[model samples]
Target: MTSGVIRRVLLSVGVIGTGQWLLSDVVHVPGGGLGVAAVAGLWWLSRSPKQPRFREPASLKGWIERCELVLNQFEELEVVLELQGLRSPREKELRRIEGFDVPLSVGVVATEGSGVPATVQLQQALAGAASLDLCLANPLPVTSTSWSWPDDLQELDVLLHVLPLPLRAADLLWLDQLPADRPVWLLLRSSVDRSAEDHLEALRCQLPERWHQCLLPWSGEAIELRGVLQPVRQQLMRAERVREGTRQRLLNNLHRRWQADLETLRRERFRLLLQRSQWIVAGVVIASPVPSVDLLAVAVGNGLMVKEMATIWSCPWSSEVLQVVARQLGSAALAQGVVELSGQALLGLAKLDGASWIAAGAMQGLSAAYLTRVVGVSMADWMALNAGVAEPDLEELKRQAPLLVARAAEQERLNLAGFAQQAHEWIQERNSCTPA
Candidate 1:
């Protein structure tokens, strides 16, 4: 009992210390340490003096209904029907040979004795989401090496590992043997002594960071199943979406016209990532003391952005390919005098005194960053136009680069001041960490 109290105190101290550090060191908030200390004190004061009371668990039917509603929220029924061509008579007849088998096959493995009953309960609860085939597996011992599946089980889409409450590090080793191709979901069942939340935290500590999203806590009671089924339903829906997307990609590959919609979706999805990369690259460039290395840094940053953009667009990614693209784009920008114009615009904004080398470097960095954004945007457009084609036309890209840079400059003019301020703070923080 004394040790528990001591541990709690130590944990509280650690949390408070970490909070203070983030507020003061990372965020640079004024008087952040004292503010965090006060907040911690208030939290400590707010702790309930009375002990928690136990209540009767809800009925199984109530839990089942709640889980059903949660699953309904995912709209799996509508999606499954559409994906399997079951919506209309014509489509249904066409898909008759395919049948209405669940697109995803989920395998449920119970780690402990209690886990077996919990798995059965979960399977019963999920019966309403008829789009998924939930097969409950034999309770596998933690040490078991040769695991067998049901003869009817052809392929497992997702693995649902059911664990008893108060999970240990040893039990998580079972995850190592599971198929890596499929996603793994951990259904944590609470024991009589421990609550579901307690089990969840224990399991979370034992599980790898990647599996954290897959963890779901459930008490044996039906009422708790609603919460547990939410993540499970989401996982199943996500898997279905992935399958549908793959089918779409294959169809697009067969037909050229279908590629337009896929390309547009890819652009929309990766636009924010590209924008963020531009800002990060710009900040890093501005922080560097030397102006001569700006071109090299911008080239490297643009190359990395191209690689990410390629992955998002489902295009082949190679460092060599990015290097060739970057060189062509950089040469065009320089020849068209876009780089020099951007530098002048940034210099005008900074309006720094001649003595300030720091301000001068910042101006160069900001210009390089703006030019990088232009290059990235132009590359995305070129990729979209030449989707599934080999090489980009250097002449056409060169013609478009200046126009794109001018348009980007106009669109981003208002945000530049705010962005520069943020970049300055970032540079300050970065420089403080550098060793002398």
Candidate 2:
């Protein structure tokens, strides 16, 4: 237990020390006194001999009950089977009453002059699969442009293109003309001497970026083909469930709730990391001697924090969007005089007698740090409310910004004091090390 505490302390000190070095040396922050001081204080606290409290584990009965509850909620949806070849006339009669819900109609297009025996074997294997409704289109000659699909082909949910090992130019052109909206799967015949790498490279060079994702190599074996087609089968099953009127609405609600729960868990886990990052940024900002550039530093640091929070919430906003949000939040803080109030509070807490410029710098740094924390918290709340649903309302966020800033100021006051103590300790350590 003693060794574990020592190890953790050492790790913490190392990380903070490295960050300090990077800020001073790489970023070339003028004076770097505040950052160095912050690092030293953090190091001393980390080295302290206090034993951390251990969290208690949940009871076994409670765990078992939770598991049972989850199991009860699990509903098994219908599975769609992938049938390969042409449906036999007799099976067509049986399919009408099989009670399988809207099985995806799959059309297999085998290019002419390709491996006929291998294609035939693949088709046969697919037809034999339990629940799939497969339609094997008539083989088209390499140059034929007038070939028409079967009248029933319009109902196909997916198209599987089976091509020879090295795709011909004509084959590529034909593939380009296929409907873009529907899912398409490309299967290439396996070569005896050539590796999968060679086959992938050949396709990558000729195919568009969109088509690259759909390419798969086929060895003409039933078991292998079944494994490769699993994703397509899953998609078909999902589509069938969506088409079922009442069940579709229930499924959609359940899916949304499940996603929301996942997002909540992720946000909880990331909140700790985000708080730690904000503390570090606060310390760094407080150390900056230049008042003019302090806000810029704060914006950059908080912009990164917003980006990370967006990723945690699975929000698809771009980096530019996040940066804009951070900037707007910062501007709001400035306009509302939140920064000035925070600076005044920090100055009162520090009670440091120094050059007017040094005091001014300290105030600016503390204010920037305070505003950054407020922005981070407000953005996180906004993202949580809109996760996987809709765009965040900037006006709503702006309206709530002042209240968030006030709350953050109260919370950050305690945090800033703790940070100042650490920074003071770091400064003392540096003084002792200096040759007197």
Candidate topping lDDT: 2
lDDT of 1: 0.53
How do all models score by TM-score? Answer: 0.36, 0.38
**What TM-score would candidate 1 get against the native?**
0.36
RMSD to the native, candidate 1?
23.4
Model 2 stretches with alpha carbons more than 4 Å out: 1-248, 259-264, 279-289, 351-364, 395-400, 403-436
Q: Summarize candidate 1's per-residue lDDT along 152-172 as a digit string, tens digits.
A: 432455667777667654455
Q: How well does candidate 1 score on lDDT at residue 91? A: 29
Where model 1 places Cα greater than 4 Å from the true spot, the runs are 1-257, 287-289, 347-360, 389-436
Worst 10 residues of 2 by lDDT: 72-81
| Model 2 error, position 430 (Å) | 8.6
Please give the CA lDDT of all the candidate structures. Answer: 0.53, 0.54
Candidate 2 residue lDDT tens string, 118-184: 4455555455434566767766566756544444544455777788877786687677766454468
